[model samples]
Target: MSAKTKNKHDQSESPRLGASAFSARSKRVTVNMGDGQKVKTLTPKQRGATTEQKSVAKDVKKVMAKCKEEHDMRLDLSRCEVTELPRYIKELSHLEEMYLYGNRLTTLPPEISSLLNLKILALSENMLSSLPDEAESLLCLKVLDLRHNRLKEVPFVVYQLRSLQTLFLRFNRVTSLTPEIKNLTQLTTLSMRENKFKELPEEIGYLRCLSVLDVAHNHLEHLPHSIGNCNQLVTLDVQHNELVDLPETIGCLTCLKRLGIRYNRIREIPAELEKCSDLEEFNIEQNKLKTLPEGLLKRFKNCSSLQLARNQFEEFPSGPPAQFGPLTSFSIEHNKVTIVPFGVFSEAKKLTKVHLKDNLISSLPLDFGSWVQITELNLASNQISKLPDDIKHLTKLEVLILSNNVIKLLPKSIGGLCNLIHLDLEGNRLESLPAEIGYLTSLTKLSVQSNRLTVLPRGIGHLVNLKHFSAGENNLTQLPEEMGTLESLEELYLNDNPNLQMLPFELALCRKLALMSIEGCPLGRLPPQVVDGGPSAIIMYLRTQGPYRAMSFS
Candidate 1:
């Protein structure tokens, strides 16, 4: 045949092979070249362009082949960028666990139900908006993690998964669950946090086996009364919601260990909650509560952590629980509390941390010395005028924040805080720091700025470990010569001290002092070394200008 007619004939006779045509047995096929000559040819290249989809298709085939040969029960295609699953996936009927998380898939295929033995399915962090109705056939599915998806509602097929023990739908768009959810008789965990749920269905009580139920960050207004039926619940967190009150039946959850209802509109806690004797952690802060339910504190025999901040209480919960337990941390800041009721904390000797800032209290009860185990005490922004001499009992305290108070003097006993590392007395009415302040050998930061101080105690030089010192905005005429002993000093701020006329030449001994601020001082003319240099240079000039005198602060 002529070349043109031969080419046309070959083109029209070219065999179009399907994907199956490339089987091992047909790797090579005989074809008529249409030129009166027969030629042997290998399998043709794949029909589509080489792209990510093509590679993924090959991966799916390989995985299926391997699983089919080994009869593997688990398959993980997580983060594989898979958008569409092949219908042949059903061939792996033995698969008991399947993870396709972090993929681009928007929907699952109905054929997925063919895996009747599947007990765990994780499709989290995907774009899935729905599951096929046929998924109800997965009767053995025990765990379903569909978090970080776009599902606007619970898939109806999910309720049919009678054996499901854990269902995580967090970070989804789901607004409500159907009453059919009660069908999950074996469900133990149900987390739907960060959704738009207004209220849970009353049928939720049917989940008697549920141990953890977290629906935080939703728009829930009230919990259904039937919730009390889940006596097995150990954790119930509804934080960041609009809940007006908890169901009185919550007291039925005797097994509850952690209950968080923060950031809600609840005005009063149900007295029935005191029945949860096993409760250990209770957080009800940022609410409209003015007083706790009577006998609430005494009932929490095992409670160790209590947070009652941002409330409207006028007095401390006095009459300390007659039989308090191992209370370790107590925070009641941003309240109207005036009387601290020292007797309340006297019973809890194991307390380690206390946050009583931003209150109206003018004085701390002398019983504060009883908390020997306390390590951090933040009593800032209160109306306190003087610290009890018993403050020396807090020898283990590491941080003491007493700023924005009207204290005129610090007790000499304050030096008893040997382990104190941070002491902030800023915005105080202090006229002077106690000479005993030098006893804090471990002190690293000390700020007495905006105070009524005339001079720093010579003992200040003993803070060998001090790295930052701020004594600005005071009536200081000069720094103590002992300050030169701060070998670890790195930053010093002495601005706005108008009466300050000169700095101690001993400051030159602070070899590590890199930053120094002495603005608003009326120091007269100085040599080049002192006028245009850092702390070290200025101190050096003073050392040469003034008579050298050896002094000992100790």
Candidate 2:
């Protein structure tokens, strides 16, 4: 399947109850940055405009005149490349919102504090290393965006903003937060990703209204136990940190919904997390976990996606099927699991995606077919040798990747997957494909490379939508003349099939055939020039010499 189509399918099936869904700052941002709220930047009138005083003065003059004439409450001077604000900016005291992002300002004029009614001030992407003392006078200010700056610490004036609700300091040089941060009791969203913080002050728990707190991509070794005091938190992302484990107080966050702790050095999950009943998305992919805490899965009744790839898990976590009641996507790839216990996933009737690739799985349980709603199933690089006939029940399966497996035979029931678009059977021991494969009319990409097949089923010609077909490194000789019916064929791989000695003349019917590989094959009847000239030249030779009328390439 094409990546666009696959992504569309994935998006439609996954639930959207994560942090981005709950944070107001994230929704208001014009440019999205992963799972965290970002600076709301605007496009400049001219790309890469310089910080010329004349241009800045002209733009500021026009904006000031408009505010004076219409009593406008919003002033937009963003991306103007201004180095300093005019001292007369104090005259715009009625302004309620101000945008000055993407500028060269290293300091703000004391006159900026004159906007006593200002609610939002965007200063992201600036050269400022600190805020002016007068900034504390903006008593009505609520949102302050200072991302992408050179600040080495949270400005002292920031702690004085009693009305502030959201604070963005991403991509800064800040190494620590003052205990005074507890002064912002109204702060709901605090995004400090990509910073140099080694630890957070325990005073963060003072914000009872805090909802979205993202501290990802930092050097923090542990989370302050005070984090549990913020009961209103919906999204807490601490991924890419050096934390060894979570504080037991985490269980007190009953309102928590999405917890992202991937790419960390955590060795075990604190059982306290089971108390967060609202949890839906739990990502712990690259941790050092060896086992799931007892009854942890059973308590997360709302979990829709669980990712534990690259962990030290040795077997499927032991639990009742009820733990998977709401699961739609699950991945445990790169583990040492040898088998999937029966009925483990039987209760997950809504399961649509599963990834168990690169494991030691030898055989899928017979109940695998129960996941009739599954769309994408990847079991590549495993030791499986055969598939159950019950696979026919997965009529909605689209992408099936079983590459590098020891499978020798495919059940004829596979043809029932009428929705399958990409089938990767590369590096398998298959001797032949079933004729029922012709029933897969939706297939666009098929791979049977490095197999022991001597001849393709005549059904190969029925795949009118097939674009990429790989049958190289096989035991094949001549291809079926029916291949001429593949009107959409674009690339064909027939390299390393030493038994192939002749070309099928009917192949000239595929007008769209642009790339064909017959390397490592001994076709003694054809001249070396014709073989070296590629598909276009070979097609021309077959048309003129064999029984077809000559046609001009033009």
Candidate 3:
């Protein structure tokens, strides 16, 4: 065939999406080859991914071929676009592990049962809907992964594998677990996330060896009380479900350490949960919970993190006027919290992050900086009108967000935070900044847009590490000449300063500037060509022009 015709025929045989499933996993790098056609190449990382994929895919065929000459055999054929098992795999009677992930195979060949010694089988991410009866004959199999498949029911044959210890069936369409599951008493870990199940069989309690159970993102309306029989369970993740209440028996699992029940319709935290003395991480956020029982809060005081955002807790609920030991991160954003009582976290010395965005808080306590270990404090979209001067005490603060508030001034000590990296004070009524702001040498991004500022601190020049400066929609008519020393500034947003009439010539010294939004500024005397040239032209003018001439664009 001619070259054009040959290319056309080859394209017809290739998958419309890509060459194979292996190619789908690699990052694509397209290059212009001219004549409307482009060629794609793989990045170094993706090239390595292809090689690794092929190596694993070929292991299955190579091992089975050499099983007769070798004592031990194993195979992995994932991501090879396989639709069926190799006819010769039965020869590897000693195969211990078989991996066939990310393929088109819909059936587990009955012939595979011949490998009586198989200990693990991974058939995740495929089109398998049912298993053959022969699957039960593999009595020695200890681990099975059928995640992200088309299975619509629990494989009854899987229950026959009494030795199975770890079972993963996440992201399947299975609706419910049957009593047959109780037969697999050796299960230690079970994952069934993103499934259609509305209930788990009470027989699940029979798995006394179960240590972890993750059924998150399912339709489970309630958990069986028998689940408490799993005395060995340590971590239980059932978030994003319709569970309205706990089984009360949850407290019976005294060994549970991490319990995640967020994004549910639960109205109250069962008092029985206090019995789980081993709990460390409790994520009950985004639920319909309006009241936080004192018992639950007291028990969770030892929790390391609590995400209680987007809940119905009005009036700060009734929990803590006490310390939460080990509590490093606490978020209660988008609630009806109007006040953050003083010394709320006085005992929580390890606190690092606290997010209270979209609340009704109006003022901060003078000792707010007492949380010395705090690194991030987000109080955006609140009603605060002023800030306490002691805000400077938060020396370790790295991120401070106070946007959309009615504040008129910043504590002069605000610049003392040497570790501050990102500071946002947009939409406030600030008139000026303290010159002490220059003390923040670690600042990388600063936002002061929609404020009443007429001048910036001359000390702003000391921020040599700043990368972004948003000062748009302000009342500034002139900027400090020191702005030209910002060697690291890449974006300058000064779009709506309408009263500005002069453009500083020193701006051309900003070698790293890639974007400048200066449209709404009324620069009456500056050369029109300079403004029209965008950021690059402005730099070129500064490079060639000896001095910033009032009337010259050259």
Candidate 4:
């Protein structure tokens, strides 16, 4: 009747899938990952020089001469301490681009305007508090980057750049922009993040070509209604502001796709957002909204991901509207959701992840297990009591976390989860697990700590892939010696099993064992030296009982 002896006997009679068959099924659950695509930035040009290019900071004269020799060339003097531009730079007026970023220059010399061929000018990260009026003479300039400077206001002369397409003014002291900023009709990207702009000029709406606008971390309390005039705007970021409400006109941006307004004082989502049909990702976490406006979810039907964490929601909305069918990921953690409507997730076929952790839900819907496509299901730290038997429908599940709950038993069908890799049942009232647990051959981490279990199924030995096992603070009088079959085991914890009487000699055979805890167990079989010794010594002493005698660490 010994567990290990019984396990070996069962292995002969039991019907199990062969490696070749299991490999085919595993492929059905596992997806072939593709190479990640490189992010495409909206910067006008790539910064930094090629590895073979020498630094041209020490001698602008020689570098400028090279630019003159070539009708069109680039001159980079960025990251150098050059305080002034030599008047000779005016001779290389044909230079197509100029870079003077990260320097000690306080002003742009009037002579810099002589570069009529300059198209890209990067003068960021300097001590510039003012720009020279002559800078306006470069009519061919298309990109202007003056970010990370001490300028309290954008130089009025910059408004004269009728050909500029991109402008950056982030991390500056610019508090006001002249009305003439609207004259940059060709601008496509404008950044003013981390600035002192208390208010944006209405003229910003005149940039019809503007597609991206970032103004996060500012003191603005309101946006002008005219901002809605940017009909081509695609991405808008205005997080960490004092705005109590968004201009109703914001819904005018029919092309907007992504909008982030987290950490704001907004109390409600504007009804006008119904016009934003293309809005894909909407982040409005950490706001003061208590009740979601009705029909709001029906507005952004195309949003793939939505986050409403850390809000004052007492109960989740009742039904899963058809509009939410396309969602891939959803989160409502750290809320007061007492009940999650069964219909809320019934339609989410493509939903890959759902996080409702740290909620007040006491029980799941009887059909909760119907969600089979989910790869990661985190319902930890809830008041759930029992899992429904149908949970086996999630055959593709990889991570199942039910820790810190009142779950008393796992469904016998849990073994059907052939792809499960991690299972956590800690801090539960479970008295026992289904022997079917042995069927989870893919399991790598299993934790049943702080439970009321008196014993584990002998079939646990079937988990040949297990690497870590935690079973502390249980009522077990004996551990199944079959656990020694975990050849891949690395860390094991069996502390606080007060009634345990002996050690499993077979455990010493686990060569991959590195950490083991067996404290609080009264075992007279082990010598005082072996008992006082740590995992290595205990393992070494046990191995001596066999034919292999070896020294080990404390």
Candidate 5:
């Protein structure tokens, strides 16, 4: 009873059908039973009906012939303009789940292999190009979607369906895969994403109980070193392929875990993935990796989220395994890391989110406390002007991005970071802000967007959980009328503070203010009492202003 009280009682017991009452209700109202008495009416059209409508049509044909003699038969002709299918549907013969998806069906009816207790067969978005070698006699088919069909070639009797296990042929004009699909061997999730597959059927390593293999946006360059013999593969999404190199027998699968080779032209990293020791989330973002195979982080010593951001790393890579155990989220953002090496993140120690944003670091190792379980520190576009006052020992910091740094000042020990929550210091040259940053108090998103702030720290109304306050491109000419006591501010961007003119009739006592940008502020207008106490205010009010602009919510 508590999941936010069952999602507010299922959003107050859901029932919201309005697109013109669901496009004029195409059948969905029913209730009628009798002889003992129970009835409600809507459907009534059995021409020449009498004698209690012929005994209610013989009790609905004896309950649909006892539900087609138990189970089976479940047909849904999607978007029904139904082109074909009624050869009395092969006399039902215990049909089982057949949905001809978004149809204009080009063909299909070798009497649909006489149903044979079919088990899920959806000819996806059809205009089907083939598939009726009696579809290999169903044999209790088990899931075959045939995605976006205009199929060039897929039915090698669908790998002789020995009880198929999920095979969705994505956007098909299928270019390959029928070496009799190495006889399916009980496939376990094989989606040929955006197909026209240019390679991939070295008998796809004979299935061997495959586990989720998505050939992402294909035209794959190379990949069938018998796909490293499938060893129960676990999620291998080949991103935007044209992969230049990979089949170092993909380090023999060793139960691979989430490996997305992003936008490849691969420049390195295949030291045969150091035998994928249970790899855990590794996305080689936009590849062309320059230098990183010095035993590739000591062979991902149980990696835990490593996205070598943007690539061609100029530094920061000394084979992560001086006992580097279970790393925790590390992104070497935009690279060419100028200098951050001094015990380079001292054995990671369960590091917590560190993305040295657009680096060229001028200074930081005043013992950056080997990242004391850091919490989201992105040193945004660096050339650091000053920070290491032992950075007040991070103390599980919560998002401190330091946007475009050249910091003019700040370290009032950053209000001893009482779990700071998002503080961006946007495009800095900060003129002010450390009156101990109004004592942090779990600050909630505060960005001094493009700074040179002329004023603001009148104890920022003691940050009672501030809620999004961005001094847009500053040179602020006014604002601390205790910022209308913030009362849970909800967005107040203060655009281009060109000597901000009005705005502090105690900010109309804040009443959860909802957005007020004050565009190019020298405010020749806008204080009809902060526009009538922000009736969900969104005033950008600009009347003729020049120069002095700034608004970067980065």
Candidate 6:
């Protein structure tokens, strides 16, 4: 056979040969050519195989070269499912930023320390059991986020990151912080909320540059006195903790603008807090404070708004410095206050709003009218029986709430309050309204529900701007025919009046009237004109037997 045919036959038989059989017969062959400088050429089959193998090898080399360049480049692989870092990651000497959030990474390779240029490292939402010792070597790291992890304790080496400015470890199981945490002098913000911290480290004061410290929703029973040493702190939220009392050193936070201590067991405030002159907002709500020291008011004289509701004070204190005139809004609702101090408001001339609801006030001082600048007053659920005549002096009063009181009558001088916009006297024993009430031309809302009123004054029609009038559950037997003059009236509640027999036909003239409720009245039907009037009127008529029921004005 020819050489080519012989080579093909050998290739076909090679597959049938056993591994040992083929190796036993394999041998190196040397051939000599006619020229003295001999040259041996491969057979046709061997040359084709060698050429193909070389081409594949070259392609693989090109691909491997590209992968090396990528492995050495900086990468931001945040929020991925990478279980472990590539071994070549150690070659990335230029890597500056790395984010590995929301992964199942259990441990980091010590080679991470090779990244000296890294500035931000986020490894949050991972199953990391502990940090590598080389973590401290990241000198250029500025921010570190490891929140929502099972970290029971922070590594001591973390304190060596002098360049760290912000650190977050929220929703972790950390029980204590190392005193070395204070070594992070460059840190400006630290969040460790929802932890098992029993108390703060005394060295915490060493973080003089910290502006925000959130240790809320923890097991902290007391704060370190050094906490007040953080002079630059502006916001401190320690709410939902077991703190029974605050340290007097808290007053040292002169730069604090907002302080929240709600949902704690705190019973009293530290008198040193009076020194927080720069404080603009302070919330101690939902505490066990029985009374506030008068000095606190003098200290926070610049405060414009204060919330002291849900406390144990039987009476509000009077010693808030006379210079605390800047106070414009005050709330003492839901307290044990039995009476408002006689002249408690005399010096509060700048006071614009006062809330005294849910108290035991039986009477108000005759001088209560001295709050001339007051615009809103809430005296609901009190025992007040009468208002002083001087109430007319409140010309600027726009809202007056006296609901659930025993008031028998309103001062006829109420008409002098031209600025009164809303008057609520619901749940009272009022028998009648003074005719002068009609002088409230600016009145837009009037509520007299659950009263003993028999009739409204004839001048009620003079309030052309009245948009809402509710007299439900009263002894009203009839409404004044002139009530139709309220061109702007939109809602009129007259239900539960068993004696009311008829409504005036003039109601048809109220072109803007929208809702009219006479459901429980003795009237059987509405006037024909009112029923045939514009679609804007929605009358809820009752079914009753009476001569007025058949009367029609059409």
In terms of lDDT, which candidate is strongest? Answer: 2
What digit string (tens of lDDT, one per residue) describes model 4 on residues 1-554?
36586345323322221221000000112223456755443321143332212233335556566667865467776655556777778887878777776666788778988988888888777888988889888899888887778989888998998898878787788887889998899988787877888888888889989998888888888888988999899988898877788898998999999998888888877878768888898778777766666666657778888787777778874344565677888888777889987667777778887888889889888777788898888898989998888888999899999999999989899999999999999999999988999999999999999999999999899999999999988988877888778989999999998887777877876778899888887766678777878667778877787444453313
RMSD value for candidate 5: 16.5
Looking at candidate 2, the ten consecutive residues that score lowest on lDDT are: 20-29
Per-residue CA lDDT of model 6 for 377-405, tens digit only, reads: 99998889999899999999999999999
lDDT of each: 0.83, 0.85, 0.81, 0.79, 0.73, 0.76
Give the alpha carbon lDDT tens digit for every residue of 112-227 in model 1.
Answer: 98999998898877899999999989989998988779999999889888999988888789999999989997988888888999989999999999998989889999999999
Tens digits of per-residue lDDT for model 3, 120-231: 8888778999998988879899878887689999888988899998888877899988898999999998888778999999999999999989898899899999999998
Q: After superposition, how far is residue 269 of candidate 6 from its true place, in Å?
A: 2.2
TM-score of each: 0.84, 0.87, 0.86, 0.80, 0.37, 0.68
Clashing residue pairs in all predictions, respectively, total 0, 0, 0, 0, 2, 0
Clashing pairs in 4: none
> Residue 440 CA error for candidate 3 (Å)?
1.6
lDDT by residue for model 2 (446-547), tens: 999999999999998999999999999998988999998898998999989998878888787777888888888776668888887865677788877876
Candidate 6 has its poorest 10 consecutive residues by lDDT at: 17-26
lDDT of 1: 0.83
**Which segments of candidate 4 are over 4 A away from where they belong?**
1-60, 78-85, 100-107, 124-129, 149-153, 173-180, 318-320, 472-479, 493-505, 514-554
lDDT of 6 at 156: 72
lDDT of 3: 0.81
Predicted candidate 5 versus true structure: per-residue lDDT over 178-277, tens digit per residue: 6778888887878886777889878889887988788887888888889888878888988888887787888888888888888878887677777887
Q: Sort by lDDT, best first.
A: 2, 1, 3, 4, 6, 5
Model 2 whole-model lDDT (C-alpha atoms): 0.85
The CA-based lDDT of model 6 is what?
0.76
